[model samples]
Target: MSEKTILVWFRNDLRIHDNEILLEAVRKADKVLPVYCFDPYYFQRTASGISKTGSFRARFLLEAVADLRKNLQGYGAELIIRTGNPAEILPQLAEQYQVNEVYHHREVAYEETEISEQVETALWKLRLNLKHFIGHTLYHKEDLPFPIKDIPDSFAVFKKKVERDSNVRPCVPTPEHIVTPEITDAGELPTLSQLGLDEIVDDPRATNYFQGGETAALVQLHKYFSQDDVAVKSKSSRNSGSNNSSKLSPWLAVGCISPRQVYWEIFKHNQDGNNQNASLLKLELLWRDYFRFMFKKHGQKFIKAKTAEDEAPVLAVNELDFNKWAHGETGVPFIDACMHELNATGYICNQCRQIVATYLVHDLKADWTRGAAYFEEKLIDYSPASNWGNWAFIAGVNDAKESKYAIAAMQPKDMVSDFVTTWQPSPIDEAGDLMHV
Candidate 1:
């Protein structure tokens, strides 16, 4: 009898370590095939008229996929790379390779869920089983204190309950060896130009230059916790306007590093002393989990409005103002600096994200959806749940109302002036008048 061939589809969950889908496939099948698809839809222009995947993120993804392929090779397996819709490519691969099963991490966001469903349907017609595992969150869905639908709308309530009740599962052990059926034609990875994106210039002023992959992720985790004492410094650094937060989101967003792995590391570090840091780290992870569960419960509606009773106030879409904001040309010095940093590096610290987001929604009175879409395009760490959820929260479209007044009350003129004097000179507006706040 021929060996049972199983195909492991790689999505955002790119890492090999603690990968439930990959682990399960290896256990159940005589041979496992690892594959990644660069869906063209993601590279295409979004509704906001920006490429859904910009150069920085595109380059990061390419690096991640390359690393994944290299790691798989070490295990005597190959990662097949393809460019197209997964729905079309996966089913064809199943037929061609006589794959008995397909395994993947489940996605909660609307578009990703739709694509998964399409692929499942196509596989069903071919008599192949499509299996999904929960690899994205720190706590498994089954282990949650409440059913996802019953999850509290208030993050505080939800966090209190989960922190008190939920347990963080240990990381899944990495497999020593992966057996694979003979395969030829391992496709080449795509370049940024091929993906219709221009090359990204490195920004020296950026807080961190992100390299994508499990190896890089693990190295970062060690450096932050061991050498940097991230826990002790994060709070002070944040208050002092130093970007010292654990810059782990990019790796976390892409599943290059599992949230559980991060949780355990923090847990181990806190076992000796300073439980405060561990608590803070876990709190952040819970927030990520909350967004994912919220998305799963609410679906597309999660991004639309906070509640049915609360109607979204009609806001005029200002194209010129939005363009200025997106390009970091807004004359408000601090806001402009943050936007310019984001545009250049595909990253900004959490505080700056809130500052710019509030500016876009409250000050500029532009549609929050436009800002969210732009972040989706530009952020190297873009997770649909976290990105949209944070945007909606700032836009006052979530259960919690962020204080727009408080954000607006902040004095940015001084900060911008200081930044300009210390750093690069501010971009000049040809007109004598600075752009209005």
Candidate 2:
């Protein structure tokens, strides 16, 4: 019999550690072929005239892929990089290597799911299988008390049930070494320019510099989970603009670290799971899982914001307000500060993000989809479910409660931080009277 070969396709789940797809590929195949396709779908400009993946996110991905290649090589395996559609590329690779099967982590969002279908269809004709592993969420779908179709519409009900009934599976261990056939022509990682994004200049005002890759993510996992600072629950994590809230999202977003890894570390650090900081962080992770599963349960129904039928404008002034807001030039100091931070750094505090997004939707009266689209282009940590889900939640489209901190942004003074002080706009009263600057 010919040696069985498994082609591992890396998507958002980029890490080698705690990755079920990688582990299963190693277990099943005599030789593993690791491939990452830089799908042009992500790089293309959207209808908003902004690239779907902006410079910061593009840079982060390129770095993460580069680091993944290094780690794979350290284990005596190579990452074959190719820039093109996965549907076209996977088949050619399967045919060339005489591969029997392909493996990857599954995604829930429509575009990602659609791409998976396209690749699966193409691979089927080649007489190969495209296997999907559901490894992205903290609670594995199989472990959930109910089936995906029956998942609670309310996060409160979902969280309570899952916490009571389900258990987090142990993290899969990182392989000490990986075996691969002697291969030629592992491709090169593309530059930001090659991906149709401009080279980014370092922003001095960014809260904290973010580096990409699983190696950096593991270091962060060790650092944050080990720190005894309960101040992680303070303004640092909750309200302020800086990355005091674990700074793990960027890595977490890209699958640099698995949710189970973070959860187990919290479990190891606080054996009883009673540490307030750990509990709160764990709760946020649960919220992340909620969004992913919500997408899985609903598909594209609630994920995409609907364009308003009556919001058509004559003066094109709506576009003017949007341009100003996107560039952080809005006169509203609080909202402007948040937008500035997001634009300058590809990040902002959770509350601050809500403040800006709410202002765009409720105050400016612009299309919520436009704000969502801008965040899609700009945020380095953007995930379809979380980003769009939260936007929908605030817009009152998705049935959810607005966080108190977000509600407080309307008060103006209550929400101001050093981030707001930096912008230094005129203070205003409840009546919209601008106080002397």
Candidate 3:
């Protein structure tokens, strides 16, 4: 007779610590199976033929999965690896392993929701349980002051109410006892080459050093707060491009890190008398939660042109102007600089992100989808909700009914003067190199 087991489906939450789903699986089942699937749908080309996940992010993801597997082994747990549609494969595994229930963290984006529904249908047909936990944000879903439908439209309004009315619950502690289920054979994770991508070395011009997995993320948080004196400069330098931001986005995006983990770390620091910068750090986490809350409410409409109206006007992908801007040859120094950084490194500062996105939509009169798709491909830490939500905001899609932000060349120069100087084109004699006002 096959042994009964609980399959903990590892989606984005990669760490063993503070993992609600994994911990719950341990609590309820004698045998627990850990699994991760490298869904082919992720690497496939889009309608426009561009890869959905570009090389940089692919490299980061590969490292993160490998790290997660290593961490699982330390706890005597084996990570099952597969490459295919989860809806089909998961049910097959459930039947084979006799896994009665599948536990995983909730994913709120368009594709993720659809995929989850398919998995649920498949599991239901087999009479198995699919239990999803919410462990992504600093704020728990059930603890929200309002129902998701009643989530506020304006960020200030939402933050004010949540801050005043809600409390940041302490994170679930990492269980000390871990039980690894017996399994005969587990597959290996895909490598960079197996994914049809080459390994990448960090670019010298890159501002932040980004890594994957939970340990790296926690180490970073510790270093930033304790060793690197990051807390001291929280207000002044967190906005700067070169090594300013927490550089936590990539891990968070892939579930290698949890926002609650970051929040509690900051909270601990504040309790230890590092109170001066605690509020600012907490605010950053709140912003992340805000994006997620918005996504939960708007669904796929967050990426739509008007959020409830017609899709945004589509622009030709091959238009000369579009190609130039996409390739970082816009001939505008500030825009070109920020774009070049994105090309060299898969990241751009939050401030620069807003500016370039606005320029693409409002200034160039390009479709928001074009810019949004490009970001989906390139950004290392790209979250579906945040990218699309911010794009819609800049494109006048969401709650910003009348405030359509069009980027002009002057805006870039004024906002990011030093960034322009840093990535100025070589061979100063060329007329094209000149920064036209």
RMSD of each: 5.5, 5.8, 5.8
What range of 10 consecutive residues in model 2 has the weakest lDDT sum? 428-437
Q: After superposition, how far is residue 124 of candidate 2 from its true place, in Å?
A: 0.6
Regions of candidate 3 where Cα sits further than 4 Å from its true position: 1-3, 198-202, 227-243, 271-277, 305-318, 400-410, 415-437
Model 3 Cα lDDT, one tens digit per residue, 157-245: 78888888888887777766666666676887777677766577767765466777887978877775673254353544433432333
Question: What TM-score does candidate 1 get on C-alpha atoms?
Answer: 0.91
Q: What C-alpha lDDT does candidate 3 achieve relative to the native structure? A: 0.73
* Top candidate (lDDT): 1
Candidate 1 global lDDT: 0.79
Tens digits of per-residue lDDT, candidate 1, 1-437, equal 88888999999988989998888888888999899999998999865568998898899899999999999999999999999999999999888888999999999998899999999999999988889889899889998899988988777888779878988888998999998877888899998988888987787765568898998989988876773365364544323433235678888888899988988898877776565545666667877888898899888787676466786675796688889888877778778877787788887666567777878887787888888889888888888888888787777776643332244345456356655422232222111010000
Model 2 lDDT at residue 282 = 76
Residue 217 miss distance in model 2 (angstroms): 0.5
Write down the lDDT of every candidate, Cα atoms only. Answer: 0.79, 0.78, 0.73
